[model samples]
Target chain A: MEYVVQTTNLSKRFGKESAVIGLDMKIRKGEIYGFLGPNGAGKTTTIRMLLGLMKASSGTIQIFEKDLNKEKINILKRVGSLVENPSYYPHLTAYENLEALRKILGVPKTRIHEVLEIVRLTEVANKKVKGFSLGMKQRLGIAASLLNSPELLILDEPTNGLDPSGIIEIRNLIKQLPAETGMTILISSHLLTEIDQMATTVGIVTKGKMIYQDSIESLRMYAQQKVLLKVSDSEQAWRSLLGNGIKADWEDGIILLSEHSDGKVAKAIHTLVHEGYSIYRVEEEKRSLEDIFLQMTTREKVI
Target chain B: MIGKLLRADFLKIKRKGLWFLSFLGPFGVIALQMVNYGVRKDYLLNQSDDDWGYFLEYVHSFTPLALVLGIAILTSFMASIENETNAWKQLISLPVSKMSVYLSKFMVLGSLLFVSSLLLGVFSLGYGILLNLGDQIPYLELLKYSFYPYLAALPILALQLWIASVSQNQGIPITTGVLGVIFAYSAFILPDWMIWKWPSLMNEWDEPLINVMLGIGVGTLLYIVGMLDFTRRDVK
Candidate 1:
């Protein structure tokens, strides 16, 4: 299937308030699609709908090229997911916890060892999950979702509770998923940097509306790149650049011109020196994924 | 699917005190008589011509209350296990239907209650032998006293299980369970149609089999209603 998940005008309302409205999501096969949204931006609600855990008020969901409502069991069999925080039987051993799910999944018994090994919990497999740390629990949750060897893995905030290094590890693991196995992943997160490194395609949502959905390259194009000019004559450089039809602003005794092309930069420099401006240093300021994400989600339209 | 779910549910509650509670219900019912016989055997023995009948009547008195309370606890415990682990979403997202999930829970509760009812039979007979109430033990009456209350308590079991399964706050089911226990305690005043009264076999008709039939029929109906409600709604 070209798209692992497709939805049109999906909406979910709780009484008078709408949790998610008019959401159109398209997630392609073999791509790590980042479902980006701020906290309470209806990320979890959308994921729940795709998994059939919650029924949509009005919408259609197709997964694995099959209608979700019609082929729920068959479609779900190839989809593995971990929603929000990982839920586990605290009293049961880690191995036993997966064993419980494995029985329900009707997978092979050895699948328990495989998942435990994949998440690197082999040594502690027999230990009760009550003692596991947050990162370990998240990993175990990932392990549980992979027990069926699903083709599409949907994880909601998988790294929500992890530390910086644990976050990096999970990000790398997600990045390696497509090469290791031809599986598509839909990972939802509020952290733009987390998604930037892990996702091939990004969907930015705010207040139940998707502000932007495209490839990472297209999302990066929205970022506002600038050239920082540290010149002795900051005022002269600003005026000269403005006269050249380039918008220039002064910040901390420097002139910043927005995304002037290489040719324009040379011309702007030539004009600066012609205006008797002493250029001490020039630095290119690349807009971060965080900047682009904030601009797209917070503004009325993606700027 | 139901069988697999039942096995999984059983494994989840392996060391969680539910099994001990199941044993306690039957053992407690028999232990109360142990004290009665130890203290005043003569008074209890002189009441009826048939010693077995008198002992059975006394045993039956405690069975209804214990069975009703046990149903409440078992159903609540089963639901709480899933709630505490937050396993409902994971279970429903599997390649199984929600109806199977409901049936699995009911079957697990039904199986545990069955075991407890069987234990009641064993404990009641062992104690009756120990009392030397009589060599002529009315095996049929003893059997009825042990299992009849279980069968007749089905409607209450189904009702409590339904309440427990859908309720997010355990207190709601517990409250309903407490009211059921109180009503079962006063079954003498309750109407025949009341599920609580069916367990006590206290109806105007005075036929135990009629109550059993009603329990099974009404119990099945409630189970279907609860299952339909559960399958139609989103799992929280």
Candidate 2:
């Protein structure tokens, strides 16, 4: 139940546009919390508030059990962040670019090489950042965030410009961070599928509102798997299911039952057969995370 | 901690051509003098009974002009380096306070200008020796000409740094800088209260030290005001 970060009623307004409205975020220790939302859904804004880069128009933020506004310096000592674009001096080599930040953060010189190795940029560390591809810049940004060995790392679109293999590499690296170093990660992205495999908990935001926040397993349940059965007599099978206290909906000629569990599917199949109906095929339709995300956000139900 | 911050600030200025301009400012001033004195030594020397005094005046006149323009370009370049790379967000999000970040920038710019002033002294002294302007080196006059303009130009430096730091578009800062240079060029017509006119060392009281004193007092005030303004706003 220990939380590393907690926000209550955090909001930001740009003139009349409510960029982030009354957001309540909770991130526990050692959890890879996926802040899932579409573009302009206030993911970047919320992260900025947490990092003390931007002030919240209203409400309070607590980091490491200290008020973020009152104890920003002390709180930031244990936190590292990469917000919006990964900024680096293009004229400087990758090593020098990181070296500049290292001097400010006061980390050891050897730590620079360690972070370079962590981001797999050691070979090209001597090259100037101006010549780097977008993916390289993104990786260097992540490497800069790790220079301090912070307890909490907030990454805004950490895998933004990476190729497929680069994405997988960063994903695995992020996945191992908690186990290897006991660091809590909050990575924001507009793509749900990207966070599907890595996130233990998720907060889905849409149009400045958090529609859902819970374990990833619970989010999967939102997809609502449906078991479609082809039966000899569909109406009679539906009637039998209704009488047996099973929820069944008829769509086209097939009997559709929600697959909450395998036991539920078995009971529905048994009841149809007990009513003397021959079943031909029982097909299960499983929805992906993308489908669930689209459904939840489109519905815009406040959780 | 400030030392570490300064070290990092130095790394950022690498290959930015600010250092080259620092050397160029003094070198250019002396080079101009070389051409002037070389072509008309008799006319220039005859104008003043004191040969050293005349040479010092000529060298000092351009000192204020160069110092003023250097302040403008140097401040704009410093801020542009950060803006170009979007380093403000990265730097501000660090454990350091915004106040220190402002101070670090001011210190770096101040140090660069200080070096340019030192170079101006060395180059002018070397060129005057080549011209054989006087048997007396006029060491005290040389020191005044080397540093007085720098001290008097402080207000402009502080103001330019403020504008450059706050402005997102370099055009805004650069435009103000060009206006400052023009004001420096027409310092005689500008009112005595004008901050840009302070660097020109022209006064009815015949006290060059008055402008230097005003520059220090006003410059410190402007720097404090600028730092507070910078700290009060959110980093872009």
Please give the TM-score that candidate 2 achieves against the real structure. Answer: 0.92
Q: Pick by TM-score: which candidate is best?
A: 2
lDDT of candidate 2 over B138-194, digit per residue (tens): 888888888888898998999999999998889998999999999998898988889
Q: Name the lDDT value of residue A112 in candidate 2.
A: 96
What lDDT tens digits, residue by residue, belong to model 1 across residues A120-167?
Answer: 899999899999999999999999999999999999999997999988
CA displacement after TM-score superposition, residue A30 of candidate 1 (Å): 0.6
Among all candidates shown, the one with the greatest lDDT: 2
- TM-score: model 1, chain A: 0.84
If you superpose only chain B onto the true chain B, what TM-score does each candidate give?
A: 0.98, 0.97
The digit string of per-residue lDDT tens for model 2 on A226-283 reads 8898998788888789899999888788988875588998999888787789999999
Off by over 4 Å in 1: A227-264, A268-286
What pairs collide in candidate 1?
Answer: none
The TM-score each candidate achieves on chain A is 0.84, 0.87
Q: Mind giving the per-residue lDDT tens digits that candidate 1 earns over B83-129? A: 88688888888888999989999988898999999999999899999
